[model samples]
Target: MPNDHYEAEQSVISGPKGKVRADSIQFFKFDGKSEVDPQKLAKDLEQLRAAVRQVPDVDPDERDRAVAALLAAQDAATEGDEVKVRANLKRVGKWVLNVAESIGVGVAIAVLRQVVASG
Candidate 1:
């Protein structure tokens, strides 16, 4: 019989001291204040979605991903999860920053910059 992986748990490391390497890292800080207005961000994202659709340079797949990221960020903002909001917005910025000007989402670009510039 083949042994199942993780049938028993082992090798647990609990502390701030370790090699600490990963392909990605998620940092969530709760500073006790909402950084963005969820309602306004939702409206901006809708505008952004319309703009992205009209952009000839953005492919279907990229458009889909960016839209999804923006929606996720909006949801995170509404839920008061700053880390998820910023992370998702960072994904949107990475996907569309180069074409943001062309897409005419200037306000959006600026907003995203404030959130993701530090990222």
Candidate 2:
């Protein structure tokens, strides 16, 4: 077994008229032989949920869908299923981009990359 790592980079948009924006990136690496950490995944999902909830002037339905996607991603991650986790994360990324666009926020492009190697 080796180490498995996942990384995501996104643009965060804020400020009046969405004039301010910054790149937000995170990395998560874990021992492939061990179980994935559900708590860490849950915490990350919580933060994303909160961010969606904070966005103003977004359609209620869209917001709800985005939150649901995050929840699904969390569940997939908890199961230690890399395939499902990746799929759900892609779904969440799309929803986030839609939410950002609807709220007049700067465009957000989420790029997810994974690396696995035997140690």
Best by TM-score: 1
Off by over 4 Å in 2: 1-38, 93-119
Tens-place lDDT per residue, model 1, 4-90, is 334322232333453644454423333444344555555666677667666677677878888788778767756766667667877
> What local lDDT does model 1 show for residue 112?
72
Give TM-scores for every candidate, taking all chains together and pairing residue i with residue i.
0.54, 0.46
Q: Please list the C-alpha lDDT of all candidates, in the order they appear.
A: 0.61, 0.51
Across residues 33-115, which tens digit of lDDT does each residue of candidate 2 receive? 43345456555665666778887777887777777877776676666555555556565435565544454422122212321
